[model samples]
Target: MNWHGLKAIYLHEMDRMRRTLFQSLVSPFISTSLYFVVFGSAIGSRITEIEGISYGSFIVPGMIMLTVLTQSISNASFGIFFPKFTNTVYELLAAPLSTFEIILGFVGAAATKSLIIGTVIILTAGIFVDLHIEHPFIMMFFLVLTCVTFSLFGFLIGIWADNFEKLQVIPILVITPLVFLGGSFYSINMLPEFWQKISLLNPVLYLVSGFRWSFYEIADVSILTSLITILFFLSACVLTIIYAFSKGYKIKN
Candidate 1:
């Protein structure tokens, strides 16, 4: 492995976003604060606590996970898609870097962005509400793992998207809706029996539940189960990306 090449690519992507650091770092916090104001304060006041945690604190994990997931996906997707769109992917293809190196570079950058944004959201949430962290170590573990997993998923999306518009289809059409309906603002128990069962089918629920477990010491779903699901999804995504790279899907053409 060309460690230098991987580091260089990672740094290059980091620098690109760093140049727009104000927007990259601040925009998410601003948007999340708005959610707190609108959803947490306004609507949350009407709704009682979920699992003994105030509605505001209850949604913090989901908000943080939402930012992490979306940022990781966007960063990874754009990192690959922009190169392909501008024909700069040819440069990488000609370079001595292996596919693993490329994935490491892009995915690492994406994960870094997700981590920063997630941290920002957490800190901002602290400003608005008092939150208790039950297991800090577990929270950090899941945060990093989730970022890396979704970043890889985004990298796959980048490879599959032939056009700029197509690149956003999944995040816009699929992910956004799943996040909201995934019980981010409310608990699954609040739903009727049928809808509660249906909500279980949404993978984001596990992510939110696991994250919430770290903070509140309570989870809508089992933390062990969520971790297992995350591992399975992460492994599957990594294998798929590797297969795509080997086949030269979209990247070669």
Candidate 2:
């Protein structure tokens, strides 16, 4: 593998992040903090506890996941899409870097950003409520898994998009809604039995449920199911990426 080339690409992406510190970092940080302020105060006043966990504390994982998911997609999609927009991707395609190196560089940087933001979200949550982790390692696992998987998904979207408008479409129109409806603020069980059954079909529920389980040992679905759901999405993203690169879907042309 071309380690130098990979590092160059990775550092370049990270440098871009450093340059756009507020948009890349501060924007989400403030947005999440506001969610805590609004949801933690307004809603928490009404629903003091959800399944024996403080309403504020219970929503922490979901809120973090919400930001992580959108940020992962936003960072990665823009990372690749800018190159395509500037006609620089042709230069990259002609370079000595392998497809794996290219993916690792972009996806790795995106995941790293998500990790930083996720950690920040956790720290921010502490100010609003007393927080404890029932399973720290499991939380990290779910966190890392979600970051990597979604980054890859975003990388895929970047490749598929031909315009800036297209880039924002899926994240705003599709992903954000899924995260909101995925039992992020409340338990699926709180839904009526009929609606609860329907909620089970939303894939993101497994992610929120699994991450929440690591925090409070309270989950709407089994941990095993959550693990499987994330792994499945990870595999799907990996395979789709492979296909895109092999076919030179948007990179070459």
Candidates' RMSD to native = 0.8, 1.0
Task: Give lDDT: candidate 1, residue 50.
Answer: 80
Q: Model 1 off-target regions past 4 Å?
A: none
- Report the C-alpha displacement of residue 251, candidate 2, in angstroms: 2.2
Model 1 scores what on Cα lDDT?
A: 0.92
Put down candidate 1 lDDT per residue, 42-114, tens digits, no spaces: 9998986888999999999999988899889999999999999899999899999999999999999999989
Give each model a TM-score: 0.98, 0.98
Badly placed stretches (over 4 Å) of model 2 are: none
Give residue 232's error in model 2 in angstroms: 0.6
Model 2, 222-244: lDDT tens per residue?
99999999999999999999989
